[model samples]
Target: MRNERKFYIDGQWVDPLKPNDLEVINPATEKPIGVIAMGTAADIDRAVAAAKRAFATYSQTSVEERLALLEKLLEIYKRRYEEMARTITAELGAPITMSTEQQADVGVGHLQGFIDALKRLKTREVLPNGDVVRREPIGVCGLITPWNWPINQIVLKVVPALATGSTCVLKPSEFTPLNAILYAEMVHEAGFPAGTFNLVNGDGLECGAALSRHRYVDMMSFTGSTRAGIAVSKDAAETVKRVTLELGGKSPNVVFADSDLEEGVADGVAQCFNNSGQSCDAPTRMLVERSAYDKALEIAERAGRQAEVGNPEEEGTHIGPLVSHIQFGRVQALIEAGVAEGARLLVGGPGKPEGFETGYFAKPTIFADVNNDMRIAREEVFGPVLSIIPFDTEEQAIAIANDTAYGLAAYVQTGDPDRADRVASRLRAGMVHINGAPHRYGSPFGGYKQSGNGREGGIFGLEDFLEIKTVHHPARM
Candidate 1:
C-alpha cells in the first residue's frame, strides 16, 4: 500500500509546494517500498514557523501538564511498537530481531523514561539568594536523526523536547524515512497540539540545511557522521543556536591479558557487529594485550565466522545487509583497503557473502595484524567489520585507544577491579564499560571530542531542552 507522501506540519499532513518525491527503498529487498514528498527550504520555513508559534504556548506549560503529555505519548507509542519494528527492518535493513529488541524498543523506552524523569523533575527550585530559579523550555528545536538507529535517535531527542515543552521540527534521514512517517502518525494520533511536533522528509542539503539555518529554531539536536555534524554546527552558527550532536566513533574494546579472554572476545565481537556495526558507539577497534594477541585474534575470527549473515527476517540471522547500495560500496572499498594495507583478513573479504545474490548483505569481516594507522582502524566503518590491533603494555593500549578523533564509547575488560578502574579513567570517551558491563537506560549517554557535545538520556537529556532563569528577589527579612 502507498503510505502518506505529505509532510507533517502544523498538526496536519500537507503536500509540499513542489511535487518533488523521493522513493523509499526497502534495503533488504532492494525494491521501492514507498515514496515521500521531498521537502524544500520553503517547507522547513513553514514547519519552523508553526513550531515557533506553538512554542509561545507550549513553553509556558507546567511541568505536571508536560509529564501528562509524555505519559500519553508513551501509551500511544506502545500500541504501535511492532509496526515500528517492522518498518525499521524493511527501511533500514536492521535484522528483524534487532528491530524488535534494540531498534523499536529503544524508542518506547526513551519516551517512558522521559515521562518518568518529568514527574520527578523540579522545574522551580529555591536558591540560597531567596530567589526562585526556574528551568524553562528553550523554544523551538530542530532534530535531525540518522538512518542507523532511526527511531532510537528520534525519540531520544523528541521525548525530551516534548517533556521540556519545546516544540520541534524533525528531519529524519532520507535513507530511512518510513519509521519517521510512522512516528508522525503516532504523534498525530496522540493529539499533540498543532505544530508541537513536525516531520519533514527530505535530504540533508534541502530540508536539513533549512532547519539548521532557520532563525526560529532555538536549538539543534543532530545524530549522524562527524562530517555532517560539523556542517550542521556551521549552518546553525549563523543564528548562534544551541547544537547537540551525537556523532561518529571508532571506540576501542581493550582486552587485557588478565581478563576472561573467551568471554571478552565474544562480547566485543557482538558489540561491534550488532546493528551491522552502524552504532555510533560500536566498539569497532579491538586492542588486545600482546601476551594474548594471538588468542584474541583466534577468538575474534571464530566469533566473526559464527555471526549468521542472511535475510533480516530469517530466524537466527545475527547480521543483516548494509542500509543502502552506497553503504555497501563504501564498506567493500574499506575492506579492500584494509587488505591492501597489510591487515590480514582472517575471515571475510570484500564482497557479499556466498549465496546472497540480492540485497546489500556483507560478510562479517575481521582484520587481524592491524596497526593503529590503518584506515579500518582509524575510520568509522559503519559495517560488520572488526579490526584487531595488538598493544604491548597498559600505557600503549591507553595511548592507542585515545588516538581516534571520535570519543563516544570505550570497552575495557579486566578481571582486576583496580586495573579496570585505572584503564577506564584514562579513556577519552564519555562512557566506559568495564568487564562487559551493560548500559543502563537512564544513565546519561553522549560523547567527548568530535563525538559531539552535550548529553542524552537521564536528567542530562532534559537539561539540554531547558533554559535556566534566575529570578532576582530581595532577601526575605
Candidate 2:
C-alpha cells in the first residue's frame, strides 16, 4: 500500500500550507523512490505553535510520567525497526544490512540510553546555602537533523528533549525524509500529547530558518556542515535562543610505531569508510610514524580494496554511493583536485567502481605522500577517500593533527597505554578514540572550535534542553 504524504503536526498527519514536493532518490539505483511534502515558513509556524501550546502542560509532567512515555516510544520503535531500516535503505542508499545494524540500531540504542539516563537524573536538588535548584524544561525546542545517520541524529535530539520534558518542532533533512516520516508515525502511535512533538520535513532555507527565528522556540539543536551551522547560529541570535550545533569534521587517526599495525590500519580504514564515508567524525586523515608508514599504507589500501561497492540492497556490499548526484560530483571534484595537485593515488581514483555505472558510486580511494597542506588532507571530502601522511616524529604528528580548523574527533593507536593517553590529551579534538575503543552511549559527544559547541549524548544532552532555576531561602537564626 502506498503511504499518504503528510507532515506530523499537532498529533496528526497534516498537509503542508504549501505543496512543494521533493523526489526522494535511491543513490544505489539513481531512481526516484518516493515523494515527500517539503515544508515552508508557514509549516514551521504551525509546528512551533503546536509545540508551544503542548509545552504548557508537558513541561510540568512528572519524571515518572515522562519516563513512561519514553518507554512507550521505545516499544513502538522496536516494532517498526525493520521498516525504519528499509526506509533508510530506499531513501539514502545505505546497504540494507548496514542500515539495519548501524543506522537503525543506533537510533534504538540512543532512545534506550535516554530512558536509562532519565531514571537516574535528579531534576531538583538542595544547595548548601538553603537554596533549591530546579532543572526545568527549556520550553519549545527546535531540532534540525542532518541526512547522514538520519535516524540516529533525530533520536539523539528528540529522545533527550522528551526526557527533559521539552516540546519540539523537528526539521529533518528533505533528502532523507522517509525515515523521519516513519519515525513520526511511530511517535504518533506512542500517543504523545497533541502539541508535544511535531515533525516538519523541509530544506534549510525554509523550515530550518523558520525554526531558528521563531520566538516561541527557546532552543535550537542543529547537526550538519560547519557552514550551515554558522547560519543557524546567526538566525537563532535574533531571538537569543540557545543553540547547540554538531558541525563538520576532518578527524585524524594517528598510529605510533609501537601500535598493532594491522589492527590500527584496519580499524582506521573501517571507521573512515563506514556509512560510505558520510560521517562527520570519520578518520579521513591518517598520520603514521615514518618507520611504519609503508606498512600502514599497505594495510589501509588492502582494507579499501576489500570494500565491496554495489546496490545497497545487495548483501556483502560494504560501500554505497554518495547520497545524491551533487555529493557524487563534489567527491569526484575533490579526487580530481588531489591528483592535479600531485598527490600519489595509490589505489582507486575518479569515476565509479567497476561494473556499477548506474548509481553515484565512486571507487574506494587512497592517496599517499599527502602533505598536510593538500586540499584532500585539509578539507572534508566526505567520501571513501583516505589520505596517508607520514610524520618523522611524535611532536610533528601532533602538530599536523592540530593544524586543521576542525576539532571534532581524533584517534590514537599505541601499545603503550600511557603514551596513547598523553598523545590523545594534546590533540585539539572533542572526542578521542583510544586503541580503537567503541563509542559509549552515555558519554558526552561533541566538538571544539569550528567543529561545534556544546555536547550531545548522556546527561549532557538532556541538560542542553533544560534551564536551571535557583531559589534562595532565609537561613535559620
Candidate 3:
C-alpha cells in the first residue's frame, strides 16, 4: 500500500505536473506492492530547468567542497543502509543475503570509490609549454538507469556527477523506483544546494525521452538494453550532447583444457546463474575446449542444482523470479527457441522452478553442444540461462568469443599465465575477467563495438561527467 506520488525537484518532493498511476509489482509473489505517479513531459521540463539553474553555482564549486559533500553523502547512506537493502529486496526480488551483501553494498562501494578517486584527481595541470589544462564539469546530466541493478547504476552515475560538480536529473526505471526515491531523500538531507539533484519517475517514453532530448541537458548517462540505448543516443544527438551507455552483453567465458576442471566450470556456472542471470556482464556463454567440454557440463549441471530458487527473503536462497511477467515471457521464449534450434538442454527448461506456480520464476536452464550461431548464444537472453559451446583450439576459442555483436565483457580460465594474457589481449570487450577474478573496484567499465560508448567507474566515470578546457596564457614562474 506504499504510494509515492511525488517527484523530487528543486530539493523538494513535489507532485508531478500531471500524474499517471503506475503499479509496481513484487516479482516473487506476483503481487502489486506499491504505486507511483509517472511523470509527463511537463515534469521533465520543470526538473531540467531546476537542474540548469543549480548548475550555475554547483559546477563552479571548489573540488574540496564537492569532496566534502561526498563524505556527507557516504555517511548518510550508511545510516539509512537497512532501508536501502529492504527497498531493493521488495522491488527487485534479490535474495535477502544478496540484497544486503552484493546489491546494496555496491552502491556504498561506488560512493567510496569516487570519494577516494576524487582525492587523487588533479583538476588542473600545466603542460611542458606552460599552457594550463583544466577539467570542468559538463553542465546538467540526465541519468536514465535500469531496474536490474538499481542502486548500483544510480550511484555510479550520480556520485560521479556530484563529485565532478555537475547537477543531475534522474529517471530511474519505473519498475524499481522506490530505492531511487529513498536516495533522493538522502540527497535532500545532505543539504546540497536546491536543484543539485532532481528525480522524475516515469517510463522511457515519457520522462526518459523528454530528458534525453532536452537541449539544456549537457550529457546523458544511460544504463539499459541496446535498443533503448540506441534510442537515447539518437535523441541526444539532436543536442549533440555527450552520451554514455552501458548496454547488453552475451559475454563469453572461455575455459582452456589445462584449467582446473571443477573450479573453472563451477565458477562459470555460478557467475551465469548469479542475479538470476540478469547482469549485463554475466558469463552467459561458456566456451570450453574440446578435451574438457563433457567434464564442464557435469560440473555446470551440479552447480545449477546447488543454486536453490525460492523466496527472496529466505536466508540462503540464491535465485528469485524474473523482474516481471514480461521478462519471464522473454526468457521462456528464448528457451523454446533453443529447443527448436536443437541446442541440447542439459537441466531445467522453460517453466517456472518447481514448487512455484504464480510468480515470474524461471528454472535455472543450461544448454550444451551450442553453436555460436544459435539464438540463445547470440542474443542477450537476460535470465538464468547458460549456453556451453566447445572450441577445438586457442585460436578457435578467441574467434568464437569475439564473434558476438556485444563487447561489454568476457572471461578466460587457464593455468598458463602467458596464455591467459594472450587470450585476454585478443578479446574485444571493455572488461575481461581472468580465472573468475572478482570485478576490479576502480577500473573503467563500459563496452566497445555495438555494446555502447564511453566508460563508467572510478576516475573514468568522473571524467565522463567532465569536459577538458585548455588555457593558453603566460608561463607560470
TM-score for each of the candidates: 0.98, 0.98, 0.99
Instruction: Put down candidate 3 lDDT per residue, 1-477, tens digits, no spaces.
Output: 788999999988898877588989999988888999999989999999999999999988998998888889889999999889988988988888888888889878888889889998889998998888999999999999999999999999999998999999999999999999999999888888999899999999888899999999999999999999999999999999999999999999999999998998998888888888999999999999999888899899888878779898886757888899999999999999999999999888988877889788899999999999999999999999999999999999999999999999999999999999999999999999999888866788899888888988899889999899999896554
lDDT of each: 0.90, 0.89, 0.92
Q: How would you encode candidate 1's per-residue C-alpha lDDT over 180-231 as one tens digit per residue?
A: 8889888888777899999998889888899999999999999999999999
Q: Which lDDT value does model 1 have at 333? A: 91
Give lDDT for model 2: 0.89
Give candidates' CA RMSD values in order. Answer: 1.1, 1.2, 1.0
Query: What value does the lDDT take at residue 426 in candidate 3?
Result: 96
Runs of candidate 1 exceeding 4 Å displacement: none
Pairs with backbone N, CA or C atoms under 3 Å apart (clashes), candidate 2:
none
Error of 2 at 103 (Å): 0.3
